[model samples]
Structure formats: structure tokens, C-alpha cells
Target chain A: MELWYSEMHTEDVKFSIRIKEQLLADKSQFQQIDVFESNEFGRFFTLDGLIMVTEKDEFIYHDMIVHVPMATNPNIKNVLVIGAGDGGTVRELSRYKSIEKIDVVEIDKLVVDVCLEYFPNTSVGFKDPRVELFYEDGLKFVRNKGSKYDLIIVDSTDPFGPGEGLFTKEFYGNCYKALTEDGILVNQHESPYYSSYAKSMQRAHKRINEFFPIARVYQAHIPTYPSGHWLFGFASKKYDPLEFDSKKWNELGLKTRYYNTNLHTACFALPNYVIDFLEESKND
Target chain B: MELWYSEMHTEDVKFSIRIKEQLLADKSQFQQIDVFESNEFGRFFTLDGLIMVTEKDEFIYHDMIVHVPMATNPNIKNVLVIGAGDGGTVRELSRYKSIEKIDVVEIDKLVVDVCLEYFPNTSVGFKDPRVELFYEDGLKFVRNKGSKYDLIIVDSTDPFGPGEGLFTKEFYGNCYKALTEDGILVNQHESPYYSSYAKSMQRAHKRINEFFPIARVYQAHIPTYPSGHWLFGFASKKYDPLEFDSKKWNELGLKTRYYNTNLHTACFALPNYVIDFLEESKND
Candidate 1:
């Protein structure tokens, strides 16, 4: 028997993977989660039928998310990661020995439970002494805090279902309050290829722009995503990702699969259409 | 009945597009030529069941192929495009009024005929006075000349079947002889994310490196391709793509969707894994 796991990239587009076995299938109070073993992608897990983490290319996403911010400010000590239940974001954040505290906010505890059981490479960071996991809504978790985190990484899902609230103006305002004076806000900005995802990307960028002095969009190619062209938003109060002395990050010498000093500068160079679309979104 | 056009990106991974209608499907003397109309990608055509051009994102491929070299040395008055049957590459080249002549050598005449009928947006370049079309095998056509063209674009299919010979060492050596001292040679380097495609990419880059003093790889996010992380090779004797004064291209005042001055510089900055892989390929 042949089993395939498919996700509708759009109403008219689908991406599928031939599965070797269905590893796990269960539900939490928030969403349904499924784990599958595949030949091309190795092992992958999905939340509410959307691909969340795949062992094959999770390093691409995690590397881009954690390292870009970490490299921007090497002195970052306290970090806040929102909705990264699989713990890949924290795994990368844990690499910095200088980082004194790493707080992870995941609304679904089942995601952490599943990752702990199935995806050890990513979930291994959960055991780090500096790491703390909070099973609570990220929107609410950041509301109670003030001027705390040096870096806030919103490694969340698409802007719908449980992740919809995290893309709102109010949520961004709370995140702004919860950040240090030189804090950097990095979030999972959706793709620009498909119209549906591009709308969410624009909305997130627009909302974040209102809160931060420097708001920029950067891109990475993550094959398993809806569109391989995935984007991330880098909104900061003091540091410009491009203006930083990359020699500081290069001196640390992190062995990364995707991120590097050269790519750190290159990723922020947005395509002209994306720049035009984001510029238009600012007015609307 | 719902119809879906699915291509196995690898043995286990499939990318599917819902078709509004099957526009055309026929076998040429060389390979299968199929065209489909879709909501997301508009109109797209394939060679031997592999996607070659999609109206929605063809601009990205055509832009990167034609403009990068043109911008590097604006003095390029002569261009030889190999296997760009759809005429999209010629369309972008015709935009530069300084380009006095463009010779397109396509192996399959049928691919051009179908595209001319269905994809007018791309095939429109054939109407330009400076554009010349030669329906012939690019390998043999390029061999009959020496130091004739200012730029040579090997815009063929994958490194197999009809496009296989174009990736050979002998073929690259022929192309090297067919270029002027300052000529630039650009070819479609395959994706690095997949093992199968990465090997092809490595082989192509390794061969191209032998003939050119300066050979480098650049990437673009082409969503419909195998991995969406597509790569292209840039090779020249004297012009390092990085050292060019981009202000010359900026003065041309051409509007582009994907290729901008910023992206022109950034696209060359490859990820660490790709760099390491290419470096390893050099030894083998």
C-alpha cells in the first residue's frame, strides 16, 4: 500500500510526500498533530494538516530565524520564542553560551510532547539549563511582561487558526512592550508568491512596521513550505541588520548549514515586486 | 472530473497544480511538449513533462538569465541563447536597446511554435528586429564559431535527454571558444536541496569552472521548479559579477520584477552548505 501526505498550498495547488509510515497522530486542546516518516523529507510533523517541521530542512528555517537575530546583536542575553513548540528555534538559540535565558512560549503542550518523543535533534534544546518552556498563548504571555527580552522570535504558523491572533496589531504592541531598549523582533513572515500567503505577509509586515523603527523583510528557500520562497520580518529599534559589523558574528564561528555572514547581508535584499507590494501594503 | 497536473520532484516528493484546462499536449521530435492553464500560475508549459516556463514566474527566470550578464557589462551587443525555445530569454534581452543582435538556437522547433501560439507574452520577442531564431542543435551550432558572441546563455532543459550534451565538458569547451575575450557564459545550474539535482548542479559547476577564469553560482527562488531553490552559474574571464559598477545598469532605468540592483548583488551570496558542496565538487 502506498500512503501520501498532501497539503493544499493554495485552493488550486497541492504538495505531497510519499510516506514510509505514519509515526503518530493525535490532538491537543488547540490543534491536531500528525507525524510521518517519508523518504525524501525523512521525518516530518504537521499541525492542523500544515507542515510545521521536517527533519530534512528544519535546519534552514531554524538557522535563518535564530542566527539572523543572534548575529545582529551578539550580546543578546535574554530571548523569547513564541509558538515554536517543536523547539527548533530554541535549539539554535541555545547555541549561544552568552545567552543567559531562553524562554519559549508554546500554546500547545502536545507539540512539545510529540517532538520530545519523535524529533530529538530539535527538541534537545528543551534540556538546556538556560531554556524555559511556557505552555500558554504567546499573545497573553508577552502582555504581562515589560522591557525584558533582548530578542523575540515569533516562529509561529500561518496567520490563521491559532496563529491568527499573533499577527494582530495589539499582539505586536505587547511584543514591543515586552522587549528591551535594543530589542529585535523577528517573526515568521509568510510567502510572497501566492496571493493568500502574500496577504498574510503584508499584514504582518504592516502591523510590525507600526511598532518598530526599522522594519525589513528577508527571504529563505525552505522546500517543504507552501512556497519554497519563505520570508521573515526583521523589525528592530536600534540595530540595522545590514549596518552591523558582521566580523563580530564571523569571529564566533558557528557551524551552520544555512546561515553565514555573507547570507546574513544577502537575505535582506528583497525582490522588487515584494518591495513594491510591501510598500503598497503600508498605505492600506 | 477534477484534473491535476502532478510532477514528481523526486521519487517520493510530488508537486501538483490544479488545471483550469489542458491547453496543449504533443510529442516533438525530441521530447514531450505539454501546456496547461492554471489559476495560480496562469499558463505554464513543460518539456518532457518537466515545467519549463510558467507565465506567473517566468519573469524571475528570464530576468535572472538575461539581465545579470547584461548588467555586468552593458557593452554586450551580441548574445547567443541556447535552447530557449519559448523566446522568454530573447524578450528580456530585447529590452536593452544597446543589444544590437540576439541569436537564439533552439533544438525543438515545435516548442517555439506552440509557445508562439499560446504564450504570446514570452514569444513576443521574436517580433523584435534584432532577435534572430535558428532552430538547430545548440551544441553543433556553437562549435562552428570562434570568439563570435559577447554573451552565451545555455538556457536548456535538465542535464539529461536533449539537454544532456549541453552539460558535458566538451560542450562547455566549445562554448568557451565561441565567446569573445570579455564574454560571459550563464547556464541553468540545478537545485542543491535534492540529492539528484545537487549532483547535476555539482557536475555542471565543475565543468564550467574548467573553461572560465571566474565561475560562480547564484540562486533564485523559482517556486514551481523541483525545489523552488533554483541556481544559475555565472562565468566570465575578466568580469567578476561583484566588481561591476551597478550604477551603469541603474542608469538604464528598466523596471524589473525580481532582478534589482540590490538583488543583483545579494543573489551571488550563496548559503554555506551550497558553498561547501561546490567547493567539494571542485576536488572531484
Candidate 2:
């Protein structure tokens, strides 16, 4: 018998993988979590049936999300990660030896537990000395924590279910208040392809633009995601991602699979249509 | 009951679209052609069950394929397009009033006929007076031709079945022979994320590097394709795509949805993993 797991990218589009075995299916307080093993993508876990990470392409996500912000400000000693319950975001952050403290706030303890049991490579950071895990709502954690973190990375899910609060204007305002003067706020910015995701992305970009002096979006090619094209939001008070000194970034000599000094600038070069669409979206 | 069309990105990974209706299905002399309408991608057609163009995102493919080479050499007056039966490539090329002629060679006539009927936005260039449609094998057409075209575009399908010859060393050699001294060659280089497509991309790049003095690959976000991250090859005898005078391209003032001056340079700044993979492929 053949078993396949499919997720609808849109109402009309679906992506499926042939599954060898179903590893686990548990309903957490927040959402439905399922883990499965597949020949193509290795082991993958989903939150509410939406692919969160796969052993195959998680590196691309981790490398892009963590490194883009870190490389922008090499002095980012205090790091805060929100909703990265799978531990992949913290895994990449822990690689930077200069980082002194790493705090992760996850609303779901079950996700961290499930990933720790199945995805060892990504969940490895949970045991790192510099890493501290907090099982709580990310939106509430940063409410009054002013200027604590040099980098705040919101490694969130979609703009629905438990993840929806993380995309609110109030959440972004809190993130702004929680950041140091040079702090960089990076969040999951959905995608620009499908309308469902694009709306979320546009909404997030607009909200973030209101709270930060510098706001931009960058892209990565992650095949496990809905469209295989995913985006990340970078908002800052002073440092623009494009203006970061490449010489300093290269000096760090961080060995990354996807993120590099050259790609730092390249990622921000939005397509002309996207530039126009984003500009026009401000009026709406 | 809802109907769907699925394409195997790999043996174990599949991408499917819910079909509002199957617009057309027939077997031509070379391959099977299918067309479907979906709310997500609008009207899309597949050749041998693989998506060729969609009303929604065909601009990304056509813009990246045609304009990248055009901007590199604005003096390009004559062009040869291989297997672009959809005529989208021709549509983009025809916009350049400086161009004197366009020759499109397609092995399958039914693909063109189908697209002309369904995809008017792309197929509009077929009605241009400058377009000369050739119902012939691209390999055979350019075999002995020497310095005939300022540009050659191999907008063929996957490196299999009808499109097999387009990826062969012999075919690239023929394309090299058929180009003017400052000639540029662009082709769909496939995606680097999936191993099947990556192998084809690696093989094509290596073969082209053997013949051309300058060879590089660029990327685009084409969601309907295998990985949504698709690549295109740029090869030239005299003009390097990067060193091309950008001031000249901007003067032409071509309004585009995807391609622009910034992306012209940014597209070539590929991920480190892709760069390493492409380089390692040289010895493969």
C-alpha cells in the first residue's frame, strides 16, 4: 500500500510526499502536530498539517533566517527567538561563538519535545549551554522586555491558528520595544506567490514598516515550504541589511550552506513587479 | 468530484493542482500535451504532463529567459529560439524595436497550436510580422549554420524525450556555431534544489562552460516548475553578462514584471550550496 501526505498550498494547489511510515500524531494544546518519515524528504514534522521542517531542507531555512540577521550585526550577543519550538533557529544561532546568551520562547512545549525525540540534528541546540528554552506565548513574553535582545528572531508559523498573534501590529510594536538601539527584528514573512500567503506577507510588511525605521524583505528557496519560495522580514532601527559591512561578515568565517556575504545583498534585490506591488500595497 | 493533475518533482515528491477543467489533451507527433484551468495559476498548459506556462507566472519565465540576454547586448538584431512553441520568448523579444528578425524552431506543432488557442498573452508574438516560425528540429536547423544569430535561446523542456538533444554537447556546440561574435545564448537550466533537475542543470552548465568563454547561471522564482526555484544559463563568446553596460539597458526603458537592472546582477548571486554544487559538477 502507498501512503502519501498532502498539504494544500492554496485552495487549488497541493504538494504531496510518499510516506514510508507515520511516526507520531499528537494534538497539543495549540495545534495538531504530526511527524512522518519519507524517502525523499527524510523525517518531517508538521504543525496543523503545514510543513514546519524537514531533515532535508531545514538547513536552508535555518541558514537564511538566523544568519541573515546575525551577519548583519556581528556583535549580536543577546538573541531572542520566538516560536521556534522545533529548535532549528536556535541551532544555527548557537553556531556563532561570540553569541553570549540565547533565549527561545515557544508557546507549545509539545513541539519542542516531539522534535527533540525525532529530529536530533535540529533539536541539538536545546542542550547548548548558551541556550535557554521558555515554554510560553511569544506575544506576551516581549510585552515589557525593553531593549534586552540585540537580535529578535520570530521563527513563526503561518498567520493563522496559534501563529496568528505573532503577526499582529501589537506584536511588532512589542518587538520594536524589546529591541536594543541597533537590534534587528527578523520574522517569517510568508511568500509572494500565492494570494493567501501574499496577503499575510503584505500585512506583515506594512505592520513592521510602521514600527521600524528600516524595513525590508528577503527571499530564500526552500522546497518543503508551500511555494518552495519563502521570505523573511528584516526590520531595524539604524542598520540596513544591504549596508552591512561584508568584510566584517566574511571575517566571522561562518560556514553556511545557503547564506553567504554575496547573497546578503542579492536577497534584497526584489523583482520589479514585487517592488511595485509592495509600494502599491502601502496605500491599501 | 474534484479533479487534479499531479507532476512528480521526484520519485517520492509530487506537486498537484486542482483542475477547474481540463482544457485540452492530445498526443502530438512528439509528446502528450495537456491544459488545465485553476484559480491559483489561471490557465496553464503542460507538455507531456509538465507545466509549460501559466497565465499567472509565465512572465517570470519569459522575462528571465529573454530580457537577461537582451539587456546584456542591446545590439542583438537577429535571434533564434528553440522549442519555445508557446511564443512567450518571442513576445518579449518583439518588444525590442531594434531587433530585425526572430526565428522560432519547434519540433512539435500541436504544442504551439494549443498554446496559441489558450495562452493569448504569451502567444501574441506569433502574430508579429518579424517572427518566422520553423516547424523543424532545433538541432538539425542550426547544425552547420555559422554566425547567423546575435542570440540563441534554447527554451526547451526537460532534458529528456523531445528536449534531449537540446542538452547534448552536440546541440550546445551547434548553438555556439550559430551565434555572432558578440552572441549570447540563454536556455532554461532547470532547478538546482531537486536532484533530478539539479543533475540536468549541472550537466548543462558543464557542457556550456566547455564551449563558451563566459558561462554563468541565474535563478528565478517559478512556482509551477519543479522547485519554484528555477535556473537559466547565460553563455557568450565576447560579451560577459555581468560586465555588460547597465546604463545602456536602462536606456531601452523596457517595462518588465520580473527582470530589472538590479535583478540582472542579483540573479547571478546564487546560494553558496548551489555554487559549490555547480563547481563540483565540473568533475562529474
Candidate 3:
């Protein structure tokens, strides 16, 4: 018998992967977490039935998220990552020798615990001496922190459920207050393709735009996402990502699979429909 | 009670769309042709269980394929499109007043007949005075031609079945001979994420690279396709797409939903993984 794990992209669209076996299924306080083995994607874990990381393509997501901001401000010494319980974000951040501290705030300890057990490769960054893990709601963790982090990565889930608060105007305002002068804020901006996700993307971007001097949107093709067209929001206080020094980043010679200097520039060049969507999203 | 249309992306992965009704199911001498109506994608047609065009996102595919080369060299007066039976490619080409003639050679007449009947918006370009439809095999049509056309677009299905010859070395060699000195050749180069499709992409690019002085690959996020990360091959005898004048194309003021001056330049900047894949493909 074949066991197929399917995710409803929309109510009318579905993506399915044939799995070898279900490895683990358990409930955390925040969400239901499950792990499965598949031939096409290797091993993957999900939160509340939404795919978090698949072994085959997790590098694409992690590389884009961590490297874009780091490449923008190579002097980024400290980073605050919110909701990346799978530890993929932190793993990429630990690669930079210039980075002094990496603080990960994951509300669900069980998500971390299970990932460490089942996804050792993804969770390997936890072993780094510069990294620290905090089990707390990201919404509350940044409430009092003032001008602390050089970069903030809101590596989150869908705008509903536990991730809903992270997309709020208040949360962005706090994140702005919690960052340094040259701080960069990168978050998992929802896709512009589907109507529902586009609304969330619009809402989050509009709020972030209110606080940041330089706010831009970029895209990557992540096949497992709601639409394969996944977006990232890059909001900065002082630096524009487009004007970043590519030579400085290239001198470091980090072997990356997805993020490169040329692609970094290219990713920000939005399609006309997406540009229109983001433009209309501001008014909405 | 529920009807769904699913295409196996790989043996282990599938993409499914919920259908309101199956509009038509017929077998041409080439392949099985089917059309379906859906709430999400509106109306869509497939060949041998593969999606050709969907009303919702057809603009993305058509916009990228037709506008990129058109923008590269705005003086392009004539184009030869092979295997675009759905008529989306021809429709995009019809937008340019500079384009005097568009000769489309489609092997299957049924794809054109059914699409014109079921997908009026997609097939609308056939009504244009500039477009000339030839229900002949594209491989045979290019055989004797020598330096006749400015642009050749292979808007074909996957490199299998009736479309197989279009990806062969002989066909590409013929296309090379069938172009003007400043001629540009673009084709569906397949996806890079999946191994099987990547091999096809490699094989096609390897063959095309052998014939052209400037052969490069570009990408677009087409969600309904196998990986949503679809690639396009752009080969030319004279012009490098990167060196093209954006201001010249922008001056045309063609209102498009997906293609724009910025994206035209940006789409050519492919990911490092794809670059490495193509590099390795040279030896294979």
C-alpha cells in the first residue's frame, strides 16, 4: 500500500508526496508536529500539517533567509531568530565567523526536541557555542528588548495560528525598537499568487513598511509551499539590500547552493503582477 | 462526489487540481487531449495528462516566453513559433506592432481546434492578421530554412512523445540554420529541482549550447508545472540578453501583467545550484 501525504495549497489545489513511512506524530502545546520519510524529499517534518522543512530542498529556504541579510550587512554580529524551531535558520547563521551571538526564540520546545531527535542535520547548529535557545512566545520575548540585535529573522509559519501575532503591527513596531541602527528584518512573507496568502502578505508588508526606512520584497521558488512562489520581506533601518557590496560577501567564500550575489540582486526584481499586488496591498 | 485531476510530477510526487467538470477528452494522432473547468485556475487543458495552460497563471508563462526575446531586440519583425497549439505564445507575440509576421507550426490540429472552442481567450491570437497557422511537424518545417527568421520559440510540451524530436540535436541544428544573423532561439528548458527533469534540461541545454555563440538559461515560477521552478533556454547568434537596453524596451510602454523591464533582466540570474547543474551537464 502507498501512503501519500497531501497538503491543500488552497481548498481547490493539493500537493502530494508518496511517503515510505510515518516516523513520528505527536502534539505540542502550540501545534501538532509530525515526521515522515519519503523517497522524493528524503525526511521531512511538519507543524500543524504544514511542511516546515524537507531534507531535499531545506537548503534553498535556509540559504535565502540567512544569507540575504548577512550578505547585506557583513558586520552583523548578533542575530535574533523567531519561531525557527527546526533550527535551519540558526544553522546557516552559525556559518559566519563574524557573528558573535545567535539567539533562537521558539515557543514550542517540543518542536525543537523532536527535530533534534529526528532531524539531527537540521538541528546541528544547536551545538555551536555562540547559539542560545529560548522557549518563549516570540511576541513577548521582544517586548522589552531595545536596540539589541543587528539582524532579526522572523522565520515563521502561516499568518494564522501561533504565527498570527508575529505579523501584527505592534510586533513589527517592537522589532523595529529592538534592532540596531543598521538593523535588517527579514520575515517569511506569504506568497502573492493565491488570494488568501496575498492578503496576509499585504497586511504584514504594509505594517512593516510603516516602521522601516527601506522595505522590499523578494521571491524564491519553494515547491512545497502553498504556491511554489514564496516571498520574503526585507525591511531595514539604514541599509538597502540592493546596494550591498557583493565583493565583500564573495571574499568570504561561503559555498551556497541557492543564494549568490547575482541572484540576490535578481530576487528583489519583482514581477509586474507581484509589484501590482504589493502596491495594491499597501492601500488595502 | 468530488472530481480531481492529478498529474504525477515524479513517480513519487503529484500535483492535483479540483475540477468542476471535465469539458473534453479526445485522442489526437499525437496524444490524449483533455480540458477541465475549476474554481481556482478557471479553465485548463492538458495533453497526455500534463497541464498546458490554465487561465489564472497562463499570463506568467506567456509573458515570460514571448516578451523576454521581444524586449531583448525590439526590432524583431518576424517570429517562428513551434508547437504552441494552445495559442498562448502566439497571443503574446501578437501584442507587438513591430512584429509583422508570426508563423506557428503545430503538429496537432486538434489542440488548436479544441482550444479555440473551449479556451477562447487563449486562442484569440489566431484571429490576428499577423499570425499564420501551419498544421505541420515543426521538426520537418525548419529543415530546409536558412537564415529566414529573427526569433524562434519552441513553446512545446515536455521533451517526450510527439515533442521528443523538438529537443533533438538535429532539430536545434536546423533551428540554428533557420535564423537570421541576429536571431534568438528560446525553448522550454524544463525544471532543475527534480532529477529526471534536470537530466532532460541538461541534455537539451548541452545540445543547444553546442550550436549557439550565446546560450544561457533563465527561470520563472510557473506553479502548475512540474516543479513550479521552470526554466527557459535563450540562445542567440549575436546578442547577449544582459547587454540589451532596458530603456529602449521600457519606451515601448507595453502594459503587461507579469513581464516588465526589471524582471526581464533579473530572470536571467539563475540560482547557484542550477548554474552548477548546467556546468556539470556539459560533460554528460
Candidate 4:
């Protein structure tokens, strides 16, 4: 007998995985959460029936998100991570010894509890002395704030449901106000291929562009994502990811499975169609 | 009520689409061919239950396959394409006026006939006077051949069925002998994420390296394929794609939907895990 877990990528498209067992399922205060074990993807979980992370490809997402900003601005000392309750983003961030303090604001404590109970590999770094876990709404935490963190990561979900407020222009304005002069913001911008994700991506980019002087989009290949083509947005007061100091990054000797010095430049090289999409998206 | 068509990405993973109807289904001499009309991916077709091409994302595959080599060596005159019955590669190649002759060899004539009847947007370039279609085995066509062509593209299916021979060392060596002094050979390299696809990718890369001094693997995000992370191998006698003449390609003024000058450099910048897999594959 085959137990299949399926998610609608769009109304017309769906992705399914055959699972060995349904490991966990429950309703969090914010949304419904389910976890399953599978052969191809190993262990995976979903929030509100949408894929959030898979054991096989979560490394790709975590690596691409945390490292790009850290590599772009090597002197980054403080970080504010929003909505990454699974602790994968903090896991990657904890690798940087230069980071003096790490603040993680997750709306759902249940997600973190489940992850710590199940995904030990990803939740490993949460115990770091520099890390602080805040059970609060990210929008409220960022709003009416004083100048602070050198880096902010919006490791969010789709634009609907619980993640809706995080993608707004008002939230972005607050994030800008909460950052130091050289602050960098990285967010899980949606994919460019499917229309649903593209619309969300365009809206996020347009909003972020209005708040930040330097804004760019980069891509990574995460097999379990809607299209396996995932994107991340980088917005900063200064630094361009393309001009990465590869020599310095190499000297840091961070042994990574996915993120590397060569990929630093490569991930930013969007296809012509994507480039055109962004241009049209900006205007549309 | 909803009608869904599903394809197994791996034994444990599958991708499905809500279909308006099955447009075409038949068993060719070589493999099973099925085409379906869908709202999301537009019109898509599968060979032996594996996706061959979709009207929505076929441009990504075609653009990457043809333009990468064309951009690498702008002066390529004579070209040979193997197993691209859909005519997308041929369509893109036909845009290059400098090419004097294009010889396409396909083992199955039925694939071509069906594609010509169905996928006209891609098959449109077959009417060009420069392209000569031959129904023959690509492996046999290149063996003991005179060095005539500057570029040989193996646009084949998975390394099973008729395409199995195309991935062998002997076939690559024959392709090496079939090219002019500055010849370039490009072929489909499978994905590196899933263990099943990774094995095929490793074998193809290892075999190609034996024949060509300048061999590299590049990636493209083709979401319809197994991993949405597809690869292409570039094995050349002389040129490296990174050293592309961007100015010259730009002067040619080809309006592409996918490939671009920046991406030409970026595609080769593979992730660390993929690079590691290739290295480990080489030794194994």
C-alpha cells in the first residue's frame, strides 16, 4: 500500500510524494502542520498542505538564503530572522563566528517544537549562545524599531495565509527602519516560472525595491519546491552579491555542501526570460 | 470533477497536471508517446511515461541546448543534431544564418512525424532549406566518419531505449572524430539531485571527459523534467563556453526567451554538491 502526500503547485499543477509513513500531523495556533517520511525525499513537512521543507533539499534552501548575505557583507555582526521556526536559517547563521547576536522571531512555536523534536540535523544550531528565540509576530517585532541588526532574513511562506503580512510594503518599510545604514535583507522570493509564484515574486520585488537602494534576485535548485526552481531576494544599503570577495570567502573555510564561492556569482545570473519577467513584473 | 495525468519523477516522487484532455497517445517503434492539453504547462507530451517536452517550458530546453554552443563558437558552419524530433533545437539553429548545413539523424521517424503534426512552434524550422532530416541511428552515422561538422548536438531521451548508445564512450569518441578542428559536442546530462538520475549524469560526464580536453557540465532549470534541475554536457576540442564572445552574439541579434549573455557565464557555475558529485563520479 502506498501513502501519497500531494500539494497543489497551482490549481492546475500538483506534486506528490509516496511516503513510508505519516510521522506527525496537527493544528498549530497559526496553521495546520504535517510531517511525513518518504524514500525519495527522506523526511518532509508541510504547513497548510504546502511544502515547507524536505530533508533531501532543505540544505539547498538554507545554504542559499543565509550564505549569500553573509558572504556579500562579511562584517555582518547582528541578524534578524523572521518566520524560520524550523531553525534551519539560524542553523546556517550560527556558522558565522563574527555574528555577535542572532534574533529569530517565529509566529508559530508549534513549528519550532515539531522541528526540534523531529529534524535534529536542521535544528542543531538553535542552542548557540548568540541565538535568541522570540515567539512573536514578525511584523510587530520589526515595526517602530530602533536602528539595529546588520542583516535581516525573511524566510517566509506563500503570500496567502499566515505569511501574508510579511510581504507587505509597510512591513518592508519597518524592516528598513530597523536596519543599520549598511543593513542587508534577504527573503524567500517566489519562483519565476509559474504564474502564481511569479505574481508573488513581482509584488515582493516591487515592494522591496521601493524601500532599498540595492535590490537583486538570485535562484537555487531545490527539488521539492513547487517547480524545483526557488528564488531569494537580496536588498541592501550597499554591497552587490555579484562582486563577492571570493578570496575572502574561501579564506573563511566554511565547508558547505551546496553554497560555494563559484555559485555566489552564478546564482545571480538569471535567464533572459526571467530577466524579461522581472522587467515586465516591475512595471506590471 | 477533475482529471489528472501524473508522471513519476522517481519511484517515490511524482508530478501531476490537471488535463483538459489527452490530445494524442500511441506506441512508436521505439517508445510510448502521449501528448496532453493542460491549463498550466499548456500542451505537454511524454515518451514512455517520461516528459519529453511541454509547450510551456520547451523554450527553456531549446534555448539552453542551441544557444550555449552557438554563443561559444559563433563561426560554427556545419552542424549535426541527433534525436531532436521535436524540431526545437533545429528551430533555434535555423536562426543562425552563418550555418551552411544542418544534418539531423533520428532513429525513430514516428517521433518526428508526430511532433511535426503536433508541436508546430518548434517544428517550424524544418521547412528551412538548410536542414536535412535523415531517419537513421546517430551512433552508426558518426562511426568511421569523415570530420565534417563543427558542432554535434545529441538531443536524446534518457540513457535507455535508443539513447543508451549515445552515452557510451565509443559514441563520444566517434563524435570527437566527426568534428572539425574546433568542434563542440553538447548532449543532455541528467540531473544530479536524485540518486537514479545522478548515476546517469556521472556516467555521461565521465565518458565525455575521456574524449574532449575542454569538457564542462552546465545546468538549466527545466521544471517539467524529473528534478526541474536538468544538465547539459559541453565537450569541445577547443573553446570553453565561459570565454564566449558576448559582443559578437549580441551583434547577431537573436531575440531569445531564455538564454542570455550573463547566463552563458553563470550556467557553468554549478553548486558545490553537484561539483562534488561529478568529482566522486569521475573517480568511481
Return the TM-scores of chain A for each candidate in numbered order.
0.99, 0.98, 0.99, 0.98
**What lDDT, from 0 to 1, does candidate 1 have?**
0.93
TM-scores for the candidates: 0.99, 0.98, 0.99, 0.99
**Which of the numbered candidates is closest to the native, going by highest DockQ?**
1
Native contacts present in candidate 3, fraction: 0.92
Off by over 4 Å in 4: none
Clashing pairs in 4: none
Q: Please write out the lDDT profile of model 4 over residues A82-178, one tens digit for every residue.
A: 9998889999999999999999999999999999998998888688999999999999999877879899999998899989999999999999999
Worst 10 residues of 3 chain B by lDDT: B248-257
RMSD in angstroms, candidate 1?
0.8
Give per-residue CA lDDT, model 1, range A78-147, as digits (tens): 9999999898998898889899999999999999999999999999989999998899999999996989
True contacts kept of 4: 0.94
> What tens digits encode model 2's per-residue C-alpha lDDT throughout B1-284?
79999999899989998889997889987999988988888999998878889999999999999988998888999999999999899999999999999999999999889888888998998999999999999989999988999999999999999999999999999899999998899999999988889999999999999999999999999888998999999999998888777888888888899999888989999998899989988898
Please list the C-alpha lDDT of all candidates, in the order they appear.
0.93, 0.91, 0.93, 0.91
Docking class of 1: high
Q: Return the clash pairs for model 1, or none.
A: none
Query: What is model 1's DockQ versus the real complex?
Result: 0.94
Residue A162's lDDT within candidate 4 is: 89
